[model samples]
Target: MAARPIGLRWKLSAAIALVSALVALALSLLVHNAARASMLDSSRDAQDERLEFALRAYDSGGQLVFDARLDDPTLPEPLRRAVVKGKRATYVEERGDGPPLVWAASQVGDQVMSLNGRFADRDRALRRMDQVLRVGSVLVVLSGTALGILIGGQLSRRLRKAAVAARELAGGATEVRVQEAIGRPARDETDELARAVDALADALRKRLEAERRVTADIAHELRTPVTGLVTAAELLPPGRPTELVRNRAQLLRTLIEDVLEVARLDGAAERADEQEVALGEFVRRRVERLDPEAAVEVTREARVRTDPRRLERILGNLLSNARRHGSPPIEVTVQGAVLRIRDHGPGFPQTLLSDGPSRFRTGTTDRARGHGLGLTIAAGQARVLGARLSFRNAQGGGAEAIVWLPAQAETDDGTPGPGSPGPA
Candidate 1:
């Protein structure tokens, strides 16, 4: 099975949250480092003041007054080495159980003097600041995530609306359009997308209108000539050759009628004249009249309310297509409100199965050829009757066309109600 796709809203929110977290962490680290350095500088200055006072008292009274000593053995080795080599030196000694000690040392003629102090107060303040910073960073991240979700939701809704409009357009709702409020001098990508969709819909509507006019015109123009041709063919001497001409002329006339029906279906002006129908009997009757050789099976008897004429047209077109493009042994099955027609042939082409049939583009093989209007007309008529029609390749290897008739209101006894008017 294919993996489900992630929605754009979640994608955008995750991205924004990640960036916000990184930014917050970086800023928190920077603030912590700067505050730590400032505290350290203040401690250094206090330590220097103590060292100067101790040195001055030793010179005046020949004794140390502060925490000062002559070359203190407890002093760190690195600090002593630095003191002996310079006039003054300072170092910090850290102990695990308590605040770190700050040390200052200087050479005194033949000996070295040193001062030491613990920065317990400063350490406590730094710890408190670290806690505050951690809390602040978390709050920043949370707020940023909330903001991201709000922004993402708004954009997702707008994009979703645009997507719905586009889908309706693809499904032949040419009059549908997307509406978005846009600025005059400044607009975002969503605004641009909405404008493009609306423009495309308008262009499509106009193009379809032009195509419908052309189709109606061509079909109308050919009608008179086609009728006259049929008459002429009938007047020919009765023979095999004359019969062939007459059949061809009648086929031409049928094609012209199919074209006109297609135009009418496209205009969306046809309405279903609903009536109660015994699906099994209807299918058998239509099959017998349309293709006597085709087999019919009433698997589960059902009576539906629908337009009989439109339903028959759908059935006739399917049977005609099966005979023209399929092998022998065509079969029709009626199960409840569903009708299935199958042909033992090569099955439908992949394109037809995937994208539905297109006019004048029959997916025909060497053994089969047609003008490709049969399935299209059938599909259109099915729509006019408010039914669902689909084509697929049967698992055992054959083409199957299925029609799901529209449901009707049930009577008090749980059976389908009597015939009623369809959609207005």
Candidate 2:
């Protein structure tokens, strides 16, 4: 089983959210660092002022010296070492149970001064700023997610609409076109896609129309000559030599008819004049007309509403192909909505089974005599009547053609199945 694919909307939304979160986090870190540095600078400046005051008030052993309680000062070891080396030293200490303290030590010509400043007020402000920044970061992430959903949803809908139009157009809906709005100053990728698909559809429609017209005109022109040839062949002497010629003339006539029929179908000139049809009787009559020796199995009697003329044409063409290309012992089966015809010949060639019939291109190399129009005509007729016609090879080796028709009524007994109109 395949896993369901994730929608583009969600994917885009996640990407936007991720980027936004990273931006927010980086901004918070920058602000946090800046605030911490500012607090430290303020503490250092206050300590410098206090150190000057302590120096002015100092008088130690007749040598003026800044006095400061440094015996228990919470100064870092680096700051203490710097002070002992007669260098100015400053450090901030954070008290676990109380408040933070800023300490400074300086020595001037054998006089040492040490000072401490209270940093509780600045620490409280920093903590408040930290809280605000944290809250702002969360809000920023949430806002980014919501914005992503809105943008992603719109994009997803636009892309999905274009996809639907293309799919419908591909399914033979000639009028199905992707409509892109004009006069927009800004056209996005989706708009470009819609325009491209619409252009392609228009070109395809014109090309197919031209091809159909050429086929119809050629077929119409050849019909008169073909009819004359058939008539001339009929008047010929009844000799074995003329037999092949007559048969060839008839084959030429069939090809012309097939071409004309396909042209009509392509031009949408055929309509289903559906009527009640008996499955068993229809198959029996068609088979009898083609070959009397072929076997037919009627598992159930069915009354189906379908275009009788089209159905007849479809069956006639199938039987004709079977006779020409298949061996003896052809069998027909009619059950409910299914009609399967199989021939005990080399199952349909691989090419025929895969690609169906192409006009003028014989379906197989072995049976190259026919023009390959019979199955093509049958397929067209089947489509006109809203039925499915498919070809496959039988299990034991033989060509099989299955026509699935809508069953209006069916029964296992030999009685006439209920006569009702099925979907045309």
Candidate 3:
């Protein structure tokens, strides 16, 4: 079988979280880039203003008077040369131990007075801003992940309810309803989906009910004529004509019986009468009853609590199917709560595996006759017994049908009566 799809909640949560993280990362980069440029411009402007102030205070100081802050020896040589030639100059100078300084020089009379200041405070401010932005970016992404998980969980819960309702409908629930999401109410796509599913289920139920009614009426109407035909065929002379007539009547009767049984199964008229069944002995007895030549191989001892009648019906149909559609020394093995019935024959058709058996498929050819209802009836009976029946093509070449029973019941004699309670 193809792998099951992942749930909607987790997919939604992951998508939202990824988008949030990308958005936060982009915003952080944009803010950090703009801040970097702005910080550099502000530092340059402040240095220029400081240089202008120092030059104004030292006017006409032919002896090269300078303020204590601007009198640093780390000024650039080009700035000093420009002052000596009675010109103005500005340059940036860096020292080994501190932040870069902005230096300006001008000549007053024949002496040179230079202005310079370190940009240490501006660099410190920019570094602090960078640290803050980094911390904020991390927090944003973390918060987004948590929010995604919360929203995803809510979406998953609503989607799962719709899924459950659909499953109930598939399992023959005549009146399945999609439940509205719990908590805060809102009209959204999820709500619309729930409405659509309920509508589809209602439509399906009506049509199926009509089809079932038609089938039941036809089966009931045929019973009287089939009884008469069977009696008339029995009274006829012992010849081929009588045998053929009798066979036709028998086939028709079996079809009618199958239809009625299916109707009962659908109407919930069947209930399991759970009883302890010894796996080894039960397998041997059932195989002997159905096909005397078929091989019975019980490798493990086990006891299961289930309806034995349903279990027998299920096994009988499977064996009949094997004989009709397959060449077999049909092999049946009981291992724990699992039973395997395999036949050496052409394996299951692709259509049968994909879509299951149709009740009306046996109406045509010899090979398609009674084999049509075999697997279908087995599946229905298995469900009645709360067991799982699966079909597969075995290795080499053959068809395999496996029945997985319910939990085993622990008992002393392994043959507890129907009403005698056993340990579950």
Candidate 4:
């Protein structure tokens, strides 16, 4: 199995969350540094005020006061050396036992007066602020991620709806469309994509309508002349040449009928008259009429509820297709609600197996032998009967076609039950 892809919503949301986290981190760092710088400045200012008072008291009594020191050797060497140079200086010394100490020194004649202040309260406040910033950053990131999920989910839904519409269109559901909600001055790429898809569906629907109309008209027009030709051929003298003409005329008539049928199927006007019937007996009867030479096998009898006429058409087309394009020894098998037809020919061409049969294309080898409408018509009728028809190459070198009846027609034990041989 192929690996599933990551959704657009997650990719967008992650991007938004990462950017939010980075922004939050940057702002937290800036605020933390700025607050730290301001606290340090306040500590220095208070120490300076105390140092001036100490200097004044020393000058009045020739002794220091207010816990002041004269040339304190315990002070940081950088601060003491700066004070000795006859200039003021400040230093912060962090102590393990207490909050950091803020030192301010000033020169007074031949002596230096210094004051010390501690910022335990300020340090605590800063720690609280840092905690608040951390919590706020987390909240910011969470909110940002939530907002991203909301926006991305909306966009992803729009794109998903458009994708579904496109797939339906490819599957021949031309009426399927993306319903986009538009607002003035707020159009986005998704809205544009929806509009483009709607436009494409319209174009395709119109083209297909024209093509079907042409096909139907041509078939109707040729029907009269083709019928007259068959009548004229019938009146000819009984001879080999006359028999050849009659056969060709009949074939032409059949081709015209097939064309008309194709047109009707394309217009989606065919409806099934469903009924329940024994599947194995039905195949045996159809095989008698279609190709008595083909082998028939019924592993275990099963009954199915489906359109008998449509089923016959599906079976007839498959048998005729095999007789015309396939090798000898065509075989039909009925097992439960499944019917399989195998032809010991060059198995269908690679193209036919892959893309399925297209009208007027009987593969690269069988192109001249027959028109490619047999499988197409069979597939169309099978669809109307709500069955799955598939083609594949058999393991022993032959073309095989399998038709699986819908679940409604199947019983769990593959035996006649309440709905067997009843109205569908």
Candidate 5:
């Protein structure tokens, strides 16, 4: 059979209880010994006083000897034996007779006299003391054990709470918390453990969020080209197959190229040329290249240190997302080191706003139109470029995303020049 494992709480409690019991037992024994010694000394003193009075009576002679009673009720039976055998002393005790007292003979002023009752009643008294000590020690040890167990149990309970919380945390339950008793401050080991667990959970949550964003972006970017290729292939006529095939083949090539661009943005074996670029000029050039029908706006000029290709992909994806999700009249703003992209469409869906963005979460409900990769790719690129990106509904009924780039220097031409590239 396998041996059962003992818990930490039980181990600690048992250790405390055992130590307490041992100490209590040792103390009880020491006290018992001291009390016994004191009682024995008092018994001996009383016996000696009785013997002294008897000696005086015997020495008085005549009527004094007849009046003197050797067996005094004040002295126990075992102590009375001190008078017998005269000059010889013996240690003997009987039940209910107390302990034996020491007796001896000594000469004073050329007279012979008997000395009796020195250490009287000690044996019986000692026996009674031993019994009492044994009983008292038992009681004291029992009481101490009980008290120790109670204290140890309470301590174990608190420690167990922390242990349970630790286990839950290890198992990935980041939100698990210890329940505090009434009027108790939440500043114990359990609370500390809970805090550490919460920190880990928060970090894990952030990492998962980043990963979901990457996955969604990849899916979204792939969906657009895939859809285009599928549509082009479907449109090919069965008759005059060669001509239809040629058009389909051209559409496939365009789809591949677009997909490759998105892939590069996703860090698919392509490295960015890290360089300082003027933010105002970069944004202007990108806007100029966009579909003329899409009304674009630029509000401020700010320089940011970033990779040129990465920055372009970031801008391109944002623009693509805006075009796909929003109306034609798009507004773009750059103020300080922040960039704002706003769309006049129906704004963000309530679900998206609440859930935030994920891999392949597109604005349009059209399942066949595009995969929701644009925002994911843009967000990923922004992260790689050491920038922050966020999306929300504008106050005046439109979807807006704000991007905060690293601070940059203003050029002589009023355009922003790169200061330093921040960490990815």
Candidate 6:
């Protein structure tokens, strides 16, 4: 037969109740015994005082006299006999006109009383105390058991919430939260466990985001150059000269370089060398280098701590994307550790605006020209550098990208001046 599994709460509560019952039982027994002994001693003391009073009365009057009445109403019915020097003495009292009474008296003036009534009374009282103690012990045990069960139930409920939260997290519900209504504080084990589960879910979400971005970036980088190469090849004359073929090949090589750069950015293959770069200067330089004829403008002065090469790649990709998909006249501005890039292009598609960033989203642009990985890579790069990136359509018909860098590299004046370097 299989053994039944006991729950922790029940086991703990049972153990506590058992211990409490044992202690209460022992204490009740001790109290009952003490009470019984005290009652017996009191009965004997009252009998002795009565005998002494009778002896004094008989000695003082010199007439064999005794009081047949007891001072205590609780005294039991018993024969009082007095014998002097082994001879029993007869006594007559005015209080009782019935038959004479005799008792054996000891040499030391001790009198012996024999009766079942006193013993019976003591026995009855002891029995009553025993019943009361038994009832009280039972009440104590039950109350303790109830208290233990209540505490155990509360703890079990909290632990169950944590377990359910863990299961939900494992099932890919990153937003699941454990209920904290059990009164356990945040520093307690249950709360700590809930926090750990939440952290795991957040980590999984970030990892998934990174993976999706990488995949989209790869497809976008590959499609652009391949399409260009195919188009150039088809346009070549049937009997093209070697010079024409060489020019087309050079174009293919440039396209390959561009593709390789995008690939490197996605793969994080660039080396990290720390540098202090002025954000304003870097943005202006990148805009000039990439698209001098595109009517690009720069504003604001900010400094950043980063690896120069990686930062350039991040900005370069953003600029290239805007030039390809946007309507031109790009605006780049930096303030403090924040950089804003806006293009006077057809703003993001309604779907993308609503959904935010998604995998392989082209944002209302032609598929052949824009594969939608550029923003994804830029976002990933920003994340790698501990920055937050956000996208939104400008009030005027255009799209705007904002990157907020880490606080450590910002100027004390809350502005990034020209002459700061790239991300480290």
Give TM-scores for every candidate, taking all chains together and pairing residue i with residue i. 0.90, 0.82, 0.78, 0.89, 0.42, 0.43
Residue-wise C-alpha lDDT for candidate 2, range 277-357, written one tens digit per residue? 777788888888767888988888787888888898888888778878888788888876678888888778778778777
CA lDDT, candidate 4, residue 42: 94
Could you tell me the lDDT of residue 160 within candidate 1? 84
Model 6 Cα lDDT, one tens digit per residue, 1-424: 9999877689778988899899988999899879866865665555455556655665587433334332223222232323333432222221254211222232224533221113456667788888988898888888888888887887788887788777866644555766443345746677777777677777877886577477557756766776776667667667657457656565555555444445555554444565788777777777688777544443455567876676776777777777777877877776666777778988767786676555356765466665466666676666566566777889978887777776455454664343322331
Best by TM-score: 1
Residue 303 displacement (Å), model 5: 2.2
Instruction: State the local distance difference test value for candidate 3.
Output: 0.73
TM-score of model 2 (CA atoms): 0.82
Better of 2 and 4 by TM-score: 4
lDDT values for all models = 0.82, 0.79, 0.73, 0.84, 0.60, 0.62
Instruction: Report model 4's TM-score to 2 decimal places.
Output: 0.89
Give the count of colliding residue pairs in each prediction: 0, 0, 0, 0, 13, 24
Q: Write the per-residue lDDT of candidate 4 for residues 265-336, one digit (tens) a residue.
A: 888778888787988898999899889999999876676778898899999999988988788899999877
Task: Give the Cα error of residue 247 in candidate 5, in Å.
Answer: 9.4
* Model 2 residue 32 CA deviation in Å: 1.6
* Candidate 6, superposed: residue stretches over 4 Å from native: 1-272, 294-299, 410-424
Candidate 6 root-mean-square deviation in Å? 14.7
Q: Clashing residue pairs, candidate 2?
A: none
**What tens-digit string does per-residue lDDT give for candidate 3 at 1-424?**
9999977666776787788778877887888779756765666566656656666665545222235234346556777776677666666665677666666666655555566666677768767877887788778767777787788777777777778877877877656677443334457777777778778877877787777788888888988899888898899999998899999898888888888777667665578998887877998998898899899987666777788888898888888888877787789987667788899988877667676666656423565456366677788887778777878888988888888876754433564322222222
